[model samples]
Target chain A: MFPSRFDLVVAQTVAEAVEAKVDAGEGGRFLAGGQSLIPMMKMRVAFPETLIDINRIAGLDAIERSNGHLQVGALVRHADVVASDATFGAVAAAAPWVADPLVRNRGTMCGSVAHCDPEGDWNSVLLATGAEVIAQGPSGERSISIADFVDGAFTSTLGEDELVVGLRIPVPSGRSGGAYLKLERKIGDYATVAVASHLELDDSGAIAAAGLALTSVNPINTKVADAEALLVGQQPSEELFAEAAELAAAAAEPRDDVRGTAAWKRQVVRTYTKRGLAAAAQQAEGS
Target chain B: MEVNITINGSEHASDVEPRTLLVDHIRRTVGLTGTHVGCDTTSCGACTVLMDGTPVKACTVLAAQADGSEVTTVEGLKGADGLHPIQSAFTDDHGLQCGFCTPGMMLVGASLIAENPDPSDDEVRWAISGNLCRCTGYINIVKAIQTAAARVAESSNGS
Candidate 1:
C-alpha cells in the first residue's frame, strides 16, 4: 500500500529540520527511522503534508557516556544500542528486546520513545530509569523528564516545532541493576505484558532507589509510583517484592484482547514484576 | 525527488515519489523481483535487504530514506562462481520448499555468516527468527545455514 503523497525535505541540520517544521505548520513530521511513521502512513492513518527527513543529519547517532549520563542520540538504532558499550541499566537490558533483528536494524530509540505507543518498550525502560528527553526546537534545546514528556498513548508533550535530539539516561552512581521482562507471542510481536525494573542498593544492602514501570497494561507506559515507594528503604526480599508486585498489578489497566483476558494479563504483570525485581536485585548484588 | 541508490554494486538512480517504499523501488524500478513483498506492515521478513551491510525490512524503509546507501538484495548474493556458498548450501540441504521466503532467508543467513563465520545452532535460529516460512518447518533451513557456514569456513581456510 502506498502512502498518501507528501513533500519531503531532506534536512541537512537540526536547524533546517526545525525550520521546515515551522514552515509546514502542524502538517510536518520528522522522519527518523521511518519504521513507525512509514507503516502508519501506508495504513493512511497518518498523512502529514511535509516530511523533514533527518537521516542525513550528522552528529545525531552517538551513544556516549559523559557527565554521568548515557546520552543516546536521536539516530541511535536499536541494533546500535545492543552493540554499543555505553548502555546501562534498563536501556541495555531492553535494547535487545525492542524488536526482531531485522526491524531493530532501522528503528531508532528516540523515535520509538517519541511515538509514545504504550506498547513500545523503550519508554518503559526510560520511565523506569528516570531518563530525560532532549528536544531541540526553534527556541533552543531543553530536557524534559520522561514522566512529564509522555502525555498519553501515541502522544507526548513535545511541541509541534520541536524535534527530539536525544535521550539522557542517568548513570547509576552506586550498585544498581536493571532487567526488562517481556512476554511476547513471538520474536517480532509486541509485549502482551512487559515490566522494566531498576534497583539501587545502599551500603547496608538496602534499597536506595527503585523504579518500576509497566507496558501494554496501561493507557500509557505506567510508572508504578506506589510500588516504587514501597521498594525504597526496604531490604530486598521475597515478601517485599511480592507486595510491590501486587501494587504494580493493581496499577495495570489492561483490556481484554486476543493476547489474553485482562485478568490473565494482570496476573502476568504481577508475576513479571516480582520476577524482574528479583533479577535486578541479583544483578545489583553481583555488581 | 531523485535518489541515487547503489544496488548490487550498480548505481540505479531514479526519481521517485516521497512515499515510494524501498521494496517497491528494488522490485519495480530496478526490476529485481528476488525480494518478495509479504505482510508489508513490517511483520514479515520477506522484504528484507541489506542496507549498508545491515538487514532492514525494505517495505518499512522509504526509497528516499535509502537514497545514498548501498543496498544488497537477494539478486546480489553471488560469488565469482555460479552460486554463493549460502545458495549452494540451501540446494545441498533441501532448505526450501516453495521458495517464497528463500530470498529473505538467504540474505539474513548471508549477513549472519559474514558477521559470525561459525555461529551455533541457536544463533542461526535467532538470526532468521524474523523471517517466516509456511512450509519446511525450519529444520532444513537452519541446517542449510549451518552447512553454509562450515563450507565457507573450509573454503577460506583452504585458500
Candidate 2:
C-alpha cells in the first residue's frame, strides 16, 4: 500500500515546521511517527497535499519533569515513555499497550493526543492525568487543556497552522496513583474498552483528587466527571468504588458494534473502573 | 526525493517518491526479498526490519523517512560467522513451517537477544507478540529464541 503523492518538508526547527504548515494551508499535516497518518494516507482516507516531517526537529523529544508537570515532547516515542523513570500513573501503564513494540518505537505521545482517536489510549490517559497540549503556531505557543484540545473523534481544537509541540502532564505533589486498563482482542489491536483511573489520597485517608476517563465507550474519549466527583471526599472501599463505577457506566454512550454489544461494553467499563480504581488506591496507599 | 540508506552494511541510495514505503524500497530497489510483506497494514510484522537497531514495520515507514539510517533485514542477520544464532536455532528447533513469517520472527528475536541476553519465557512471548505465525503454534518459536539466547551466552562465557 502506498500513500498519495505529496511534498515533504523536513523542518529543522519548530518555527520552520509551523511556517510550512501555514504555507501548505488546510491540506497540510505535520508527520510525526506516521503510524496512524501514514496508514490513513495509504488507504486514501486522508490526502494531504503537503507533509511537514517533524522527525528531524531537535529538542522535541525530551521527557522531563519541569515546573509542576511531566513534559513529553512531540517526538517522545511511546517506547521512550515506557523506559523513562519520570513517567508515572496512567502514562506508564498505557505506554506498552499502544499498538505494539514496533509501532511504539516511533509513535509519539503528542501525535497520539493530536490524533484523538476514540480508541487511542494516550488521550484518555492524558485526560485522566490532567495533561495539557502545548500548541505552537504563527502567533506563538499556548497551552490547551486535554478536555478542550480534543474537540471530537479524530479531531482537535488545533488550528490549521498550529503544531502540537508537546504535552504536559501535571505531577502529583501528594500521594497519588494511576492505572490504565484496556480490553483488546489481541496484541496491537485497538481497545475493545479501556479505562483510566487516577487517585490521590489525603492525610485523612480520603480521596483528595480523583480522575476517571473511559475509552471507546463514546464518540470521543469521555471523562467521567460525575464519577470522579463521587470519588473525591470519600474513603476507599468496595461499596464506594461500586457507586462510582455505576456512575461511569451511566456516562458511557456506547453503540452496538462487532467488538461486542453496547451493554457488554458498558459492563466492562463498570468493572474496569472499579478494578482500576482499587489498584490505583492501593498504589497510592503504598506511596 | 533521494534517500540514502545503508542496508546489510551496503550503502544504497536512490531517488523515490514521497509515498514509497520502506518495504517496497528494500525489495524492489535494493532487491532484498528476505523481508516479506504479509499484511500491508501494520497489523502483521512480516515487514519488520531494524531501523537504526530498533525493529519497526517497514510497510508503515516511508522510504524517505529512513533517509540516513541503517536498516537490517533478514539478509543482514548472518554475521561474519555463518548464519545468525537465532537463524540456526530456528532451523534446529523447527520453529517455522510455512517459512513466510520466519524472516520477521528471526529479526525480532535477534533484536530481543541483543537487548536481553537471557530472556524469560514470557519475555520471549511478549517480544514476538507483534509478529504472527499461523504455523508451529509459536511453541517452537519461543523455544528457538530461548535456545539461541543460551547459545549466545555460553559462547560469550567460553570466549
Candidate 3:
C-alpha cells in the first residue's frame, strides 16, 4: 500500500488536469500510467497531497505519422507504440524490451521521458533519434528537443504545473536504420549499460550520419557526438565499428552499482555499441 | 469521490477514498477478487486488467482515473457459454500451481494473444515477462500462451 493520502481528481480535459494541479499548488502530482509515480509513492519517496488523473483526457493517446515525422501523444502506452505501425521499426523494437510487458502496456513514452532515469531505454532512444518533447503549461504549449529536455536523472525541464503532451521524432531519410541494445543483469531490471544507435547511409553504402547515445553510464543520457563523427564517410566494417565503440567507451562515465562496476559497464557499453551499430548498419544497407 | 465505471459489462458506481486504487475498487467494491495485488509497487503484474480494451496494472491506476472507462477483469473474459480460451489453455497446460498469479497471467496473456495470434516463442516470453509465477517456472505458462494462441486462431478461422 502507498504511504501518502491524496485527493484524486479525474480530469476530463488537459485544461482540467492542469487546473487541478495548479489548484493543488505544490502538493499535486499528475498521474498518467503511474508506472513510475505510483511506485515511488508506495516506497514513500513521493508524497503528493493531490493526484490529478489525466487518463480520462481525450486525444492524449494517439500515434500517427505527420509531416514526415512520427507524432506520438503523451498517453500512448509503450505496448501500443511497440505494436503500432506508426513508430519506425527500430523505435518500436525498444518499447517491448522496456521493463516488462505489463509496464509496457501501462507506461507511456512521455512518462518514461519525463521520468528521465539514467537507465531508461526510451530516453536513450529518444536522444539517439533527436526526438522533441511537447510540453503544455498553464501559459501555453512549448516544444523542447530531447537533448535539452532531460536535465539529469529523475529530472526534466518540466515546470511544476507543466505536462508533457506529446513527442515528435523526425524520420530519417535515405536508408537510415536504428537499434537499441542494453546489458541487464536480469529481466525487468534497469539496464547496467545501454546504447541506441542510428545510422544513415549514403548512396555508396557509406555512413552519411550517425547518432549514438549511452544510458546508465552517467547522471543523464550522453550523446557521443565524437563517436558518431567517427562513423561518417565510412562503412560499418568491424574495424570502423571497433573504433567507434572504443570512442563510445572512452566517452562514457559509468558509476559503480550492484549490477556492475564502472569498468564492467564501460566494457559492456563498448560491446553493445559495436553490436548495435553493426546491426543498424545491416538494416541501413537492406533499406 | 463517487466514480461510475463499467466492470465486466455491468455498470457500477461506488464511493471510494481518494487514494483507492482501481485494483481495490474492482476487488472490494465491485466484488471481483480475481485481480490480485501482488506487489504494492508497479513491478508485478498481479493486478493486470483491461481498461478500455488495453491491458494495464490496476494497482497503479487510481479508481477515479477509471471513472468512465470500461474495465474487464478475469471474470469478464468468460462468455456465457464457458471459460475464455486463454483460461482453458492455462488449465490444459498446467500453467499454475498456486494460482495466485493466474488471474494476471490470464489477463496479460489474453491481451497478448488478442494482439498477435501467432507470436513467436520469444515474443510469448516477452509478452508475459511482467507477470511472475514462482510455481510453474514459466515453462508451462509459455506453452499455455502458445496453446491459447492456437485455439484462438482456430476459433477465428472456424467462425
Give the Å shift of residue A180 in candidate 2: 0.6
**Residue A203 of model 2, lDDT score:** 94
Which segments of model 1 are wrong by more than 4 Å?
A: none
Candidate 3 colliding pairs? none
Per-residue lDDT tens digits for candidate 1, residues A128-148, read 999999999999999999999
Q: Give the i-RMS of model 2 in Å.
A: 0.7
Query: How good is model 3 by TM-score?
Result: 0.92
* Candidate that would win on DockQ: 1
The estimated TM-scores of all candidates read 0.99, 0.99, 0.92
Model 1: docking quality category: high
The lDDT-based order of candidates, best leading, equals 1, 2, 3
lDDT of 2 by residue, A73-159 (tens): 999999899899998888888888999888998888899899999999988898898889999999999999999999899999998
Error of 3 at A162 (Å): 2.1
lDDT of 1 at B138: 92
**iRMSD for every model:** 0.8, 0.7, 1.6
- Give the alpha carbon lDDT tens digit for every residue of B57-154 in model 1: 99999999998899999889996677999999999999999999999999999999999999998999999988999894599999999999999999
